[model samples]
Target chain A: MESIQNLLIGFNDIFSVYNMIIIFLGSMFGTIVGALPGLGPSAGIALLIPLTFGMPVGSALSLLVGAYMGTMYGGRITAILINTPGDAPAIMTAQDGYPLMLQGKGGLALGISAFSSFIGGIFGLIVLVFGAPIVSKVAINFGPPEYFMLMVLGLSTITLLAGKSMSKAVMMALVGFALGMVGSDYVSGFVRFDFTPELIEGVDFVAIIIGLYGISEVFLNIENLVHLKMGKPSFKVKEFIPSISDIKKITMPTLRGSLIGTLIGILPGAGGTIATFLSYATEKKIAKNPEKFGNGAIEGLAAPEAANNASVPGALIPLITLGIPGSGGTAIMLGALIMYGLRPGPLLMVESGRLVWLMIAGLIIANVFLLFSNILLIPVFINIIRMIQKYLSPIVTVLCILGAYSLNYGMFNIWIVLIFGVLGYFMKKFDYPSGPLILSVVLAPLTENYFRQSIMLSRGSFSIFLTRPVSLGIILLLITIFAFSFIKKGRNSKNQDYSEE
Target chain B: MKLMERIFIIGMMIFSGLVIYEGIKLPIKSEYTIGPGFLPIVIGIGIFISSISCIVQSVYKYKKLDTDTKFISKEGATRLGIFIAVLTGALLLNEIFGLLISMVVFMIVILRYVEKYSWFVSIRVAIISNIIFYLIFEIWLRVPLPGINL
Candidate 1:
């Protein structure tokens, strides 16, 4: 009831035509910018902030928050249409979404993702409105040991991604971990692998992703002569709308994803990347037809998309309630709040309740606005691929090159993309799962830093992970997850044998 | 495929060995914390062990593995070569001509040769696409793409 009253108060502030138009245009522009390679939520928010400088604080916050939501929604566009994810969070989306595209259901993929993103956004906003103070308490209580366990939990999904050979996936993951460590050592500040001056900042994961998923995928498509499985442009209802059965299938997964995303997004640095990953893994594990995952399962497509969007509001809970930014986008929002003369700590909600509620209200409106806009624009988006199917290889190649180049405005990352492009080809040829490699690359340094910090805080005792209650609880959860997965795998193999007999 | 798998295993082992050597050369511990070398050392060992297991599994399955599986068609391989060449050549050309000229050249070459589009279609598409890319990245986004002066 209080949450409702606060939201109504927010709506009153942002109900005018000018603010409505601002929210609409901000989200629309953000969608385009975010869909392109080399731009993300942080870039989108940063670019829009100065433009909103002279506006009333309420209106400015609404526009920025709307764009923030738009960027998250936009990531799935490329990941579904092309195999390239705009960023790490969309990686799992591509695993299933792109496959659905290949199977000639690109329109359905876009629709399902948009709907899930909307549901997830609204769900997270509800939690943010009512649960922010409570959740903020939980988030701040997390220590290094708890964070270390969280990283472990994130890494444990590697086995789920292992295609057929566990050893090969482990090898790729280990390699990714090594590559991730190439930059400065967080503990001692020592440069371990400064083969080039670029090594000082570490291997750019975005460049590698562009190479591995984007460039390498273009290579494989050219080799296989199926650059995109773009069918004749069809404006049929089924192509753009989910059937009732499809909705029934995705409903539970979307809810599950929203729950997981809200819970995990509050953990700083463990934002949508891990949430989407864990959501995908959970759906895969409990799925009736687990094999359908990664091969265009609508559940697989919907769940991670939900988690990705939900993490936005989930990520904001800490920032609004406790002044802690959970992810890079929220970190910028933190700066924006500070610049607006707003203190972001515990006094934040008490001091600036209207502004925070306005932002939440803005996100709610943006989610609804983006759903209609993205869905209505589906034919236009998919038609671009259909109309230019012949020229896609070069176009995608150029985009990948530009994407890598835009990271640093130097030719260096472009070369990195090319090198990894060839490497990615072979990895695919030999059936190596790129997921583990990418996941390990993202988490390796963070995990190491957390482990080191935990050790230091515990006076060099390694038992801190087990001694802390939350950390110990995470270990048990990991144990349960792994145990159940192994049991299910054993049972499945036995079933296969029985069928054969 | 079998031979390539063996080579990949050897390459991983070598990579793991280098990581171990580099790790040993770096300090193992810093005051009150594990040093920078510790994680790399552990990861190196992890890779080494995993590589060994993969090698054993490969060797044990060598007899049963099919060496003659059709990996890719001949024409497919040829197209792949041309595609990669065009991509790299475009980047090299970017150093001289910048992103526009290089990519325009890339579009024409790829469309005309690889996709086997006619010269009329190829050149037209090439110019139009580069213009759109330029207006978006260089003009709108202000990316300062290579060789914008040209």
Candidate 2:
């Protein structure tokens, strides 16, 4: 009953004219942005965050959350039309979606994808709404030790899943942690590595994000410019809805994908791309006609699309409940939440129930808007792809500069962006994953504060971490994960050697 | 790529050593708990160990495999250099010439030279983008871009 009342209040809060307009605009903008190749949801959100700086927290979150959800659905349009996925998760969609397009069922493919995405999104939201509060209820009793262990688990998971080479990912994460430590200590007020006055407050999160995701992405895309032929999309209003038999076929796959996506989404560092791939593979394995899986099968398009969209809400569960981001997109959102002076964690629901509920409510609303907007604006979005393709690099470069500079109105921030831009480019060039680096940067300070506080509580006794059951459990989990990764890596390398001969 | 990986591992080891050296100069322990240097020292050590392991792995892989990949081409290297130069030039010029002027010049150069667009198309894109940015950042968001004093 209380949950219903809270949701009602949340709806009331988001129904305001200003908030509604922002949500609509954010959804439209996200769809268009997501349709562009190389600028995925993370980059889209980072680049657009500056625009929301002036709005109220509820309004700002509504806009950003709407965009985040919108991008999940929007990415499929380009996959179906151009054979080039707008984002990483959409790569699977392109495999079957493009084949469907060649068979002159592009409109139907897009319609099914949109519908599956909506189902997945709503499924994920339901899980988030129910699961987050429960998690927070348990997490509320956690102390510094538990928090520290949780962060360690989070960092380890990201490192293990981020790249092929565990050592490189670990190295990148350590670099990020060190970079994050280069500011005045919060408790002691001792400046650790203040090379400049700007370093006193710490490197601006927005500047680094813009540099790493935005500017570096621009550098890469410009270097490998592939001219995609933007063909006209074939669509009839009558053909938009799937047939009854087709719906029946996809219903089971959509449910399975949504479930799989939500579960994977809850895991730290395993994001939408992994969920989509897993879902696609699972659907193929279960299908009676496995050979037809990637050959324009409706099940192929439905499963991954559903999985990717569902993973969006799945990723948010940890962020809102435990103050830990499960994926890169949620990490950026966590950064935005911090910028708004709201600390996300178990207490987030207690202190700002309205904001939390409203964000949840806004995502549901956004998914509904996404379903309609994607279908209604498919023609417009296709046209936008052509227009954006030519000027994508230059436009992104300007946006990156503007986004970085607007943080504090200082040149120093821009310089930070440039330096990290170069660093990020090289990291990408060498196949080093940047996700772990960004995650470490965001989580390092939290982890350090918790560690120090735990020691203080225990009077410099490191055993405090092991004394707590929750903390001990988390540490054990981290060790298990690390051991598993090491063993798996060894087996894979041995297999590689055998194959090489 | 293999050689670059080896160089990166070596560079990381040296960087971690420097961090440890600097960290040792700070207060490692406080009366109640760990000091600020604690994390840096821990992270530095972690990096040093990870980098060493990376070097070992690289050497093992190198010994097992024949080098068959070309890391870069002349054209790619030149393109990257030009991109870096343009980015640096924009950053340096943003303070002196103002953001709009520098950005306009940067966009024009990238669009015309790097992207190989015609002069007319390049200037049109530059002018239009500048206007859009000026309107959005300066007027709407109320963020003051660096501007030349009249």
Candidate 3:
């Protein structure tokens, strides 16, 4: 009864004119930003954070959250229309979305993707609304040891993702840890890496975020300038809505993707990129004819796109519960919350249940609008893709710069964005996963500070990490993952040697 | 790539060694007491181990590969270097000119030069972006933007 009443209240809050406008504007801007390759939710929200400072916290969060989810949906447009993925998560979408376009089913593909996104988003929203309180309560039992173990478990995901080169991922994680050290010590007030006073506040989250996502992507776009060509396809108005057949094909994949994405979202540090990729791979593996997956399969196009949208709300779970951002985008959201003077963790739910409920409620409303907008806007969005990529690329590059600068009202951050832009390009070139580095950067300070604090409190006794049952469980889980990965790597190498022989 | 790997590893070793040295200088309360330096020292050691592993892996991989390619294709390396240089340039300019001027100038220059947009387009973008920025950031949020005192 209370849940229903809360939902009703949430609807009332969302129906207000100002809140509706915020959601619309956020979705519109987010879609445009996400449709452009390279600028994902992290950069978009970071860039927009400073701009949303004066508004009521709920309104500001509505705008940003709408944008975040909008980008998740928006990336599919470019992925389907062009072979270019708008962001990393969309890479999986491009695998089949581009193929669908080739088959001249771009409109149908877009339709199914939009519907799948709606379904998946609703699923994630329900999870957020119903599951957030329980998760927050569970987090209340977490001490420093639990946090330390959680970080270790999160770090282990790098090994899971590193494929054959787990060592490089570990190395990158260490580099990220070092980068996290650039600011002052939380305990003794000693500055570690502040060679200049500019770094005394430590590496600005927005700066590093822009550097990685915005600048690196700009360089890549510029490098790929010659390959900037568009393919043409006429959309059928009737096919803008998915057929029953299309829905049947997408249902299983979308369900599977949403479940995986939601789970990944709840876990700290694994963002949409991993969730989407994992979902796509899982769908392909489970499909009867795997060869059809990258060749315009409806399931292929729907799975990752749905998962990506699902993961946005999923990631918010930990952010709201433990005050730990599960991914870089969530980290930006966390930073925004802090900037707005709102503490976002277990206490946030306890002290400000209304705002939490309102935000979750706004997401459901936004998802409905997103579905409605995506269905109607397919043809219009496709028309924009017909514009010259050369011109669009320059505009995107400009947007990246402005976006980076908008954070912190400083150009220094813009520079950081540029640096990370270049570094990201090289990291890509070197086959190093940028996701681990990002997760490390987001979690490193918290992990280090908590670890140090716990150790200091325990008088340097390391046993506290083992003595706490929750922390011990997480640590054991990390060890199990490491052992499993080690065995897997050994088997893979053996297979490689056998192939050579 | 091998040469780049070597340089990176050597740089890491030097950087981590310096950190470890600095970390050791912080005052310790007791043998059991975790000082301000403990975490840094641990981090330094972790860096050293990771760098060593990276160097080893690079060497092993280098031996297995055909050494035909120049250490990272020149075009790729140059593009990456230029990207880094531009970013570093932006940061330096921010310190000198303040945030807004440096950012607007950086965006305009990057769009015009590297991206090769026309001067008219670049300047127009700069002006329009600056105005929107002023409205959103200065007027709405009340954030104090750097490099725009005048």
List runs of model 3 lying over 4 Å from the truth.
Answer: A1-15, A161-164, A231-236, A267-294, A323-326, A334-346, A382-415, A456-460, B28-33, B68-113, B116-131, B138-150
Ranking by lDDT: 2, 1, 3
Q: TM-scores of all models?
A: 0.70, 0.96, 0.86
Show the lowest summed lDDT stretch of 10 residues, model 3 chain A.
A388-397
- Candidate 2 per-residue lDDT, tens place, A285-326, comes to 999999997789999999999999999999898889888787
Q: Per-prediction DockQ scores?
A: 0.48, 0.70, 0.42
lDDT of 1 at A342: 87
- Model 1, residue pairs in steric clash: none
Looking at model 1, residue B22 earns an lDDT score of 80
- Compared with the true structure, what per-residue lDDT tens digits does model 3 show for residues A183-226? 77767777776677778887776667666766566666656554
Which prediction has the highest TM-score against the true structure?
2
Fraction of native contacts, model 2:
0.71
Better of 1 and 3 by DockQ: 1
Question: What is the clash count for each candidate, in the order shown?
Answer: 0, 0, 10
lDDT string for model 1 (B1-150, tens) is 677877888889999998888888898888777988887799999999999999888786677665646667898899999988887888787877888788889889988988888999999999998897777577655777777444
Q: What lDDT does candidate 2 reach at residue A154?
A: 73
lDDT of 1 by residue, A1-501 (tens): 877898899899889898898899789767765665545676567556545555789888988988999888888887988787766788999999999988989889998999999899889888888887565456556777887786676566666656677798889889989998998875677898788998899887767766776577667777877644544445554576788999999999999999898888876556788999999999999999999998999999999989999999998876677555555567567657866888665567677888888888899999999998888875664565355556766776777777666667888988998888877888888788776776677667767878989999988888898888989998998898779768877888799889979
Candidates 1 and 2 compared by lDDT, better number: 2
